[model samples]
Target: MDELGIIEQGVDWRTRLGQDIRDCMINDILFSLQTKLQSTSTTLIDLQKVAARIEERIHTIASDYGDYLRRICLTRGDLDSYDVLLNDCQRQQASIRSSILLHQENKQGDQIVQAKRNTMGTSSSSVLSNQVALNDHKEHSHPYEKDMISKLPNDLVQHIMSFLSMREAVRTSVLSHWWVNQWTFLKSIQLNIYWFHMDREKFSSFLDKLLLSRVQADAPMDTFELKSFAIDRANCWINHAIKHNAKVLKFAEYGKWEPFYLDPNLVELSSRYLETLELTNVALDATIFSQLANSCPALQNMLLTDCLLEVEEISSSSLKNLDIIDCYILKDLSICTPSLVSLCIKNERTDNSSFRNSYLIFATVIIIDASSVSSMELLAMDRQFTFVEKDGGEPMFNNLRNLSLGLWCINNMFSPLRRFVRHSPMLRMVTLRISPLDWKSHLTKEHQEMLISIRDRRGLILYIDWY
Candidate 1:
């Protein structure tokens, strides 16, 4: 009961402390794995379930021995084995995350390639007919004997019909008299000339009938989309859409400048509730902007492509996202939207000088007053146009996080680019897409000047496209 007893007590205390340290380390590892698994998008549910199982196994292994010293002694090698297992799990997670990110990048690359093609309505009639056929299949695929779809409440049935194209939804009338008037209460109206076998008159007549059928219905038109090469009687169709209180209006047509000049009054009429307006290949006047500013209280997104904006300034209070692509007749594109968050300006001209004459070239000065804009992209075919900053000071792009410029801009406009870099304090990434030209063009004196300027600028993360 002297020196030997005291030494034995000290040994017991040390073993207990070591056991406690091992348990705490194991717990930390489990917690870290769980947190990481939760943050991941792919395999989250599966990984969480696996982690729970592993945690349970660890708990069982650790709790088997009541005495901490005894447990530490019994599973010392097992603890080392657990450490190896955890390391393997982390490595597996990293591999899975890498694979997922690679897959997403590949998917995004495919989408970018598809977007570059930009061909609209290839085989319009054929595609319309095929879509109708698919709808017909969906209509008949479910066996009525076991299906409760028909018995669903009117609102739910209406929701189901909303998923189908207007033609397919109307075809349901032939299925049962109970569904005869259901399509009349549709919240969306989408009309395509090809739906009537490319017969313009028939298409026009069908749309008139459909609109007339819904005239007395209590339903409001939430979305109205029209896709056609050109519609002779577009005025009547547009009037009906506005009268029905369309909240989202999209017209994709080829008006060819001379034939189509949209009525500015139309914008005024739908301004109360119109949240999104997208027009392609239509002509517009300066009055359109004034109408939008004065009337469109709820408008959030506006997209103009291959259209003529007879106005210099596009000022709106409610607009959040504005995308102008291939629009012309602008002396000064002065955007003054306070709530605007994103602005994208795409090519108004092409690389081929011969065909470039046909495109509507933008004005020289682009005056942007949207202080809230965080993401700005200027993707132009030609390296032209000047960005007019306020008061000639360090331009106030206070929250700008992403800036994308055409490669031609980087090659030619060194002063403006430098100003932009100085202005954007929070700039995170700069993406440069090269123009479709020979690499030899980038080796010119102008390119040398730009390279020198870029090198002088510090704290820029440049991302150049190799493809």
Candidate 2:
């Protein structure tokens, strides 16, 4: 009996000792991991606090700004509808004779289309010419049929002169009684005022006379184009025309100008009942952009140039095509739009060291397509955003079918592309827009090889454009 007890006690002792060693080993490993994890947690918490403080500062800075930011902010809120809106807006037929007025087979595939050089002039004839030189010399002198054809139906004349400039239409009015009243009722009032044509004062005078007459005479102005200049006159002109519900507005001011501010009341309007708005300016502010995102409910197409949209995050469920060109002061870009199809984001650099701007520096611009967005074009001339040695990133986008980008975005391109490529394995067409070939001449042989290495792996459409 004593021998049996001793055997049992030894067995129990062995099992207990084995368990103690196992537990001790686990505790030692766990203690080391806990120490490492604690250090990491502290670092993360510190980062989070810094980020929060930076964000707070950004908000405070913007809030402290004058109405300058408020006015130039791109928004469609509270726009006041005024002056000349079309009488027959419900009338769907643009014209009874629906024929292809002009069609030019573009040779420039997909370059930043030369502004004036690219647009096709509307004409009744089959040929596409730079000018339709049909001037009756009599008002300068008139053709014999001027008196008779002048009485042609108002709608017919409106249709006929839809393609003609306001100057041509004014001259046409001098021809006959029939044309006089119709010219005053033009459906589209084009203010194609070139800076080269007149000085600033002279331009302002012309705009005032034209806009006042349109409002006073109640012209059916549907489209406005005074994109070349940025005077107080242009501001007033846009202010008036937007009230009239001009559907197609273009102001591509690629040329530089003296920096100026806008009237805040102008930005905060209630009458942005249009489909498209294209603005290329010196710079844009944040609030106006936010107001616009809030106000413009039916907007379809939008373009921004050399501008800044402070909306940090953009969410448009109805917008289709968005073009951000040379916009440097954009950060915190978050967009979730179902109906968005084409998105083109150009220069995305911020030279300023403001936290909002810096955070936006290498931050990823994400795009989600629940709608019909098939085409994506991103053009960056240089490393758009500022980055430090430990900036810790590259740009990334997901679910894009057609991706177009400039090859030099470096971390901005590679990081995002790597993730996007993996996430969107079904991406079909990727286009790379090559800038002036002058870039290649200065690059080292190794750099060129590295570029080739990236390209060799990803089959993409390379589009080269020479300045």
The parts of candidate 2 lying over 4 Å away from their true place are 1-146, 228-230, 252-254, 259-262, 308-311, 330-332, 347-372, 382-399, 408-413, 433-467
Candidate 1 yields a Cα-based lDDT of: 0.59
Task: For candidate 2, report its TM-score.
Answer: 0.56
Taking the candidates one at a time, how many backbone clashes does each contain?
Answer: 0, 18
Expressed as tens digits, the lDDT of each residue in 68-179 for candidate 2 is 1232121101111111112232122234123222222333443323221223223211111111222233241234443677557867777888888765665554456444
TM-scores of the models, in the order given: 0.62, 0.56
Model 1, TM vs. native: 0.62
| Top candidate (lDDT) | 1
lDDT of 1 by residue, 83-198 (tens): 22224544665685576555556665664534322222223333334333223233332235454455779888887998988766755644443565676677987876544444
Q: Could you tell me the lDDT of residue 294 within candidate 2?
A: 70
lDDT of each: 0.59, 0.48
RMSD of 1: 28.8
Instruction: List per-candidate RMSD values in Å.
Output: 28.8, 24.0
* TM-score leader: 1
